[model samples]
Target: MDTARENRTWGALSDLPGHPMMWVLILTETVTFGLLFAIFAITGVVHSDVFSAGRAQLDPVLGGVNTLVLITSGWLAALAVEARVIGRRTIARLLLAGAAALGCVFTAIKVVEYATKVSVGIGLETDTFFTLYFLATGFHLLHVILGVIIIAAVAMYDSLDNLKTGTAFWHMVDLVWVVMYPLIYLVG
Candidate 1:
């Protein structure tokens, strides 16, 4: 009975999308971000005034634009995976390029957002809200940069499995940002 259960577990894992290891990364990242999000929420309630002021300072328009950019990038990444599965290597590469380009745009917008904050002297020490804001968004920005690099590498390599794995990472990055935008930008 134990052997049967073990085999069932392994079989379920094997049927997951992308590389099994990539799912591991997705699960790990999701848990980490979830913890940060909960902390941010609890801290917001504890320091409601600080969080409100911090949210007011942020540019929701820019955050909305970034959200759209990431969503579209995720779509392109998905398309690239589909194209790869269909043996359309060139199309898949093009799709990946589009995805990576959007990733670059997202990164650029985030840098601009950070620069705007810094120009006004709003560093991480500004308050509890700013501290969590910088830490969470900065960590997410790092993932975007890494996702772009991985997408480019996958495009060059152009294997179906590699494309699926790399795009899966990209989608994970996108998912984080989608959840984060409203929480960090609009929640009050």
Candidate 2:
């Protein structure tokens, strides 16, 4: 109600672990990815055969490896938050670096996968399945790139708030893949 109360109320939001802005962004990203997943599911249901063949063309082993890598990156990002909290700025920076490196590795693998698709003459208009695959994963890949940039900034700036915000973004990226791996690669 009063000014102090309002400030306190806003500050209370900060006490919930990460920055509130980061949480808001995470919610936005989640909704966007959720809609994409829904679209994928509906499209797959309509063209079941094409979707099945598309999933088969994808290498589940590579998807699994990337899943492992991203999860580890998310863990490292969490550690970065802990390290920053305890005044271990250097360690936090190093951990952020590790996380960003893992994200880049994931991106590289995606690039290779895209190349494989290209070589096989699979373009955006190749079919409904390929179109959805590229749209979903390619959008996710952009998020990965943005997450890496956030990691770099947090590592250099080195604050509890920065670490929390950056890692929040990184974790969202990882979460998207967790759904995407099964939805686009393993399932029909």
Candidate 3:
């Protein structure tokens, strides 16, 4: 009876899951990003002049557009997860594709922005502010790239169950951008 009960419990836990591993992964990622943000905050406070000057060089309009793109992608991803939960596999795939495409758009824009900055002689070596700006944004861009990959993986999966795991990771990526957008674009 005890063996049967144990088997039942294991089955219930594993079978009733939607990306059980994603929560732990997301938690670790959040802590890493949180530390990066804290470092930036401390540096900004202590070196306001450098940060302010570096920020002045940034094109707020471009940043604003990127922010919009990320937010929209996040919305789409959330919808995709909902669709999956409801067993609408086609809609979920479409939404996941849309989210992935938006991520590509974001990366393209960032490339252009970075090229423009480099052409104008503004780079990581320019100043303390530029250094921090590039480091933070570059790290975030890496996350975006990873998100694109994950979303693409979800798009390729034939089963909703498989796609659900990728969606969870994508959601965490979206959450990070929501925090980053306001912090990097508006507050400075």
Candidate 4:
């Protein structure tokens, strides 16, 4: 590849945070979720009553707690990246572990919330609101699970770039939840 042409083609990657290739994954996932969010907003507007009733069924307080958990986790992940960059490998690993633990906590809370909904006979088939509610949240929950795994793996592997990449994914998970929580649980 010609050097200048190659730089022209791949130059934007140089400015992205974490491993350059990881940004590709990030962009793809973000666009996917963005579409889901758009669809959700449009559908909610179309069926305002259904969405409103579904929102009433949710516990905003619990969603708030999960928001706090993920935010804290993302903070720890950022700290871990900084630590790794500074050659504090042990501290970095510990911070990554902590971040992953918070991710697990988020997962547990979400599972409990789902269980509560199920026990009350609320589920995917209940209505349009419940259906989108389950699908969107469920998909995001799966990403959270994967993020926890990635964070844990990066902690074990112990490389600065790997840590950055893993935590970048975790942060995306956090951002998605930050957006999704209000839209699904509190918004009209």
In terms of lDDT, the best-performing candidate is 1
TM-score-sorted candidate list, best first: 4, 1, 2, 3
Reference-based lDDT, each prediction:
0.93, 0.89, 0.80, 0.92
Tens-place lDDT digits, model 2, residues 46-165: 999989887888899899999999999999999888988899888888888999999999999999989998998988898899999999999999999999998998898877877877
Q: Candidate 2 at 112: error in angstroms?
A: 0.5
| Model 2 segments more than 4 A misplaced | 1-15
How big is the positional error of residue 68 in model 1, measured in Å on the Cα after superposition?
0.6
Cα deviation at 10, candidate 1, in Å, is 4.5
TM-score, every prediction: 0.94, 0.93, 0.85, 0.94
The TM-score, computed over Cα atoms with residue i paired to residue i, of candidate 4 is 0.94
Give per-residue lDDT, candidate 4, residue 27.
Answer: 89
User: Clashing residue pairs, candidate 2?
Assistant: none
Query: Which segments of candidate 3 are over 4 A away from where they belong?
Result: 1-17
Candidate 3 residue pairs in backbone clash:
none
Better of 1 and 3 by lDDT: 1
What is the Å distance of residue 120 in model 1 from its true position? 0.5
Cα lDDT of model 4 by residue, 1-188, tens digit: 78777755657886777787888989899999999999999999999998888889999999999999999999999999999888999999889889999999999999999999999999899999999999999999999999999998998998887987888899999999999998888878
Q: Which of the predicted structures, 1 or 2, would earn the higher TM-score when compared with the native? A: 1
Using lDDT as the measure, name the better of candidate 3 and candidate 4.
4
Candidate 4, lDDT over the whole model: 0.92
Candidate number with the higher lDDT (2 or 3) = 2
